[model samples]
Target: MHSLPDVSLRYGSLQVFHSLEEYKESGVCKIPGAVTLGKFDGVHIGHQKLIRKIMDFAHANSISSIVFAIEIQDRPILSHEERAVYLESLGVDILVECPFSREFMSMRAETFAREVLSETMHASYVCVGTDFGFGCRREGTASMLADLGRQYGFQVEIAAKERLFQEDVSSSRVRKALAKGDMKLANALLGRPYPVMGIVQHGRHLGTGIGVPTVNVHPGANKILPPDGVYASCTRLPDQTIRTGITNLGIRPTVGGKTRKAETTLFDFQADLYGQTIQTDLLDYLRPEHKFSSLDELKSQIGRDRESALAILPDECDRFYGGPAFEFHGQG
Candidate 1:
């Protein structure tokens, strides 16, 4: 198996691919030498290795790091904005998000190879995963692509599948791990912690009145949630500051609420965080979500939850909590 490349590309300062128009308008791929690549669903660690190879190959050969992928019609597990941001962070020079529809899906593998890969992308080289398949019933394989590369005058490089702890690593596997609250295994494969980002909204303010302030975040409807439970999480505020908090992900039982919502109460935080975008990374699972009859019951459980959460939080956070410098935002 060919060694997979390293994927430690810094994302803190890269331009993201948001639209096809933005990509074409940039004219970056119009350069004499340009390589094209795929849909890259999760842009997960394995995908990163492939992308890194493409980027490195492009740099060494003076080719544009053009990535061809389906943008719409194919529902993304991650929002386009989020996926684009992550890909950009991985240093993809040009990202072409094609609309993947029944029409595209029904096209012959030959047509996809010639029309999409050769004509539309004008790619000098194509990179793909060994198990990659395309067309109706997913007919195409790496060998077929290699055959096309021979006929179309472009090169094809297939990346070896990535593995972790002797097991193949994939988005599906990571998803399963997350569903089971296996954060360590998931993070080990993801190369970083999984974070849920969303804008904070106004809740009933019930927790605040009880001295347990909380931030309400409406996650992307389709976004996967860790089994409804309380988690020890780190919340990243817009200002890039991170705070430790205990987050409840489930229907509110104490106040007779029926909707399943995520409520995060930042310990020792007294800021109004309404309308702020924040991200939470679940570090540990505390317990399965449950229903309680009374406010007192819920409050008592929360108190215990806070104590447990604090024990799990980094020591530095405990020292900083309630300090004058630890100012929070939102309606105070």
Candidate 2:
């Protein structure tokens, strides 16, 4: 398993407020802005549409654009780091990550409006999905929010939910797609390849003994991984270099692997990446995970997986790896 160092993280130029008090300490509550509230698990295309609408409205009104994101009760679809990076790239001026503790979850509908919507953030307009809810036992509805806005002197705007391929797009839908090894559909829903960010950890040097080398990454508990399989993927190095690679997300049965991990072997690169943070973007699925009878057979199969991956992926590594293509696709 990988270990993450305890440290404060930043998202490009955008400031992240981890708590309401922290936001108040930053003196941002004084700034009038249009706000959106949600858990924002994946920040997928559906989320993009909602955020863009709020941003456009705020811009037209010459006010700030803020996203009041809440912590998810379940395991998060994307790591906090990945979400922050994507939100900043989407042109959000501020990200208020409200803690979803027991006390906050028990707050009443009216109190949420007064404490968070009116006094704390000082929002002029509030935007949300048609199904959005808040406060104690989800007693707050979009309609209730609009009425509350009227009482608090703010406007409420509700954006229609997004539908993709006759089915509504959602973080849970993306996860279901990944669970079935459908990276293509998942990519379309997310507007980018699936990315998992983590520090490179030490592993049994089975690859090297078999004449190939790889870096092993252990995703955090909250980060959801695609179904176990061999994938055509790309890696972003700490130096910002994009490297073409083949990744495997599964337990190496032949090598006696016990835990599921993301293992990647880059083409034409030989360097030590242990302890360095890296992002591996899975572009396409090549094959299902299998149990090999021997190391020789496993090595031969890997050679085939690499060739198949190269045939399916772009020849120029930077074309889709770390360049502009990854901007809104959640590679950062």
Candidate 3:
């Protein structure tokens, strides 16, 4: 078991109500208003601004602030847990994370307003972006939500849409930036570096022979991989310490000719990390993967790569040592 928190009662600065029973159970609970926060991928600067408005509105109205986020939605770029973490960090009093099912997706706009917003979440207010849409092929527009709010005796706050450099800030834009390996723009829009998580898996130990040992990681199939190339990245170990590494995120044409593998050559680190989870953030692209004629040539190229990585990396490289070399041959 993951040993996670309670499914029903989620702790928050804002009292999180799950179902109608939970809402009705807590009677006379400070006007019982809530706002529907969306997928909120990256928790970008624009998202932060809108959330702040929602918090301020709820506070000024003397109502318990509720931020309703969905789980397993059709378009979620981040997990429900990740979204909850970011919201709680920003002082979201209550967070309602409900499974987005077929029933919920097919519900009428009015029913969604009544069941989700009013009955379940006990929302007296709803805040959404100007481009927000919902319910049955996305029939619930901001205008519909506003109308529903009036009908349900609640207020709807429409947050003005935001843009970065004259382009609307959106998850699609962020994905595009990441796809192009434009980390600077992506970070600027995201307000933090984008990252990928994977578990350390054992690989044919080719690095030790070259005097540079590496840990192999296969990123979760669902987790999007950045553009293929050698990247200067930071690895966050299970122990919570960050280490610098050079990552190759492409088909290993040199050694593993048939199967491509994503490998991280950690600098100055030596620990048994197999089966442990690792988070890596790409800082800069170093070079394209090149095939070498022989082991000596490959090692020479890797040495140069290490030097380049060290120079680009902020701190001194760790002179880490690990297990002995194992042979791996490319079956071309």
Candidate 4:
């Protein structure tokens, strides 16, 4: 057996254990927690309900809150790092990125529940979606988990799947919306704008020549993205400043570019951002990417894109700066 190191890393206020074995070795397992497990690909509204249940239970019982995020896909709506940030923002106490290795894939459901959930993690309460499946070949269902919870001395809470537009909110649905470049529908399902994070890289500086300097960032292979198009975007700079911009996500065929990257031009902001990580959220789809005959044509179109982006972004900035307030009603 290949043993993983006893590693526990901290992200903001959340503690992350690479695997169940690492959690046991870190000695943090001594603290009983309300636990929830899922792939949580997009951390969509459906997943948020499960997380909220565990958070409420943990807070009421004065126990730690833990999330077991199973890694099962190569291209996820959000990268593992982005998921960790979202989980931390939701106030989860710990995150375990459990690798779905062959050993784990073949493990019996009952054994997983007993060894990992009951004994090792000391889960007092467990939450999952109604359609959740686990164990080898997905032989374990929500009902099976509930039965196991009874045997293992833990309570199980099954949250119903969230629906929007009479359709179930799922990671796959989010991906489809993005693939269609339906940013509005995608963001509505996500309960937030679709975000892309990457380190700004050096480019051909074509935008500079057109008098519209831009920053370039590659979204990476593991992160799924919308179609290649120009989008009205809101970017969070390294300094934590939010700037509205127009972002083009593609190979820049107009400039004879071959690399796929997100090239963004902030409306009224300019600073050297190379080597720094920035996050851009796609707010709305402006237009599909097109090859222009000349730099002047591209520049003129970019000016029009700026105007269109300005029209849609001011309201977004208002809401973003104001933030949202949540009122939690006690579970009856």
Overall lDDT per candidate, in order of appearance: 0.68, 0.82, 0.66, 0.84
Clash count per candidate: 4, 0, 8, 0
Pick out the ten consecutive residues of candidate 4 with the lowest summed lDDT: 1-10
Structure candidate 1, residue pairs in collision: 272-329, 272-330, 272-331, 273-330
Q: 195-228, model 2: which lDDT tens digit per residue?
A: 8888899998879888889999987776878888
Q: What are the RMSDs of all candidates, in order?
A: 6.9, 4.7, 8.6, 7.1
lDDT (Cα, tens digit) per residue for candidate 4, span 1-332: 11111112335788988887899999999999999999888988888888899999999999999999998855899876667766776789999888889999999899989998999999999999989998888999999999999999999988888999999999889989989999888888887778887778999888998899999998867789999999988777755556778999999998898988999998777789898777788998999999999999999999999888888776665543334432111111
Query: Per-residue lDDT for 305 in model 3?
Result: 75
The stretch of ten residues in a row with the least summed lDDT in candidate 1 is 1-10
Candidate 3, position 19, lDDT: 41
Best by lDDT: 4
Listed in order, each prediction's TM-score against the native is 0.80, 0.87, 0.73, 0.91
Give the residue spans of candidate 2 off by over 4 A. Answer: 1-9, 60-62, 315-332
Off by over 4 Å in 4: 1-10, 318-321, 324-332
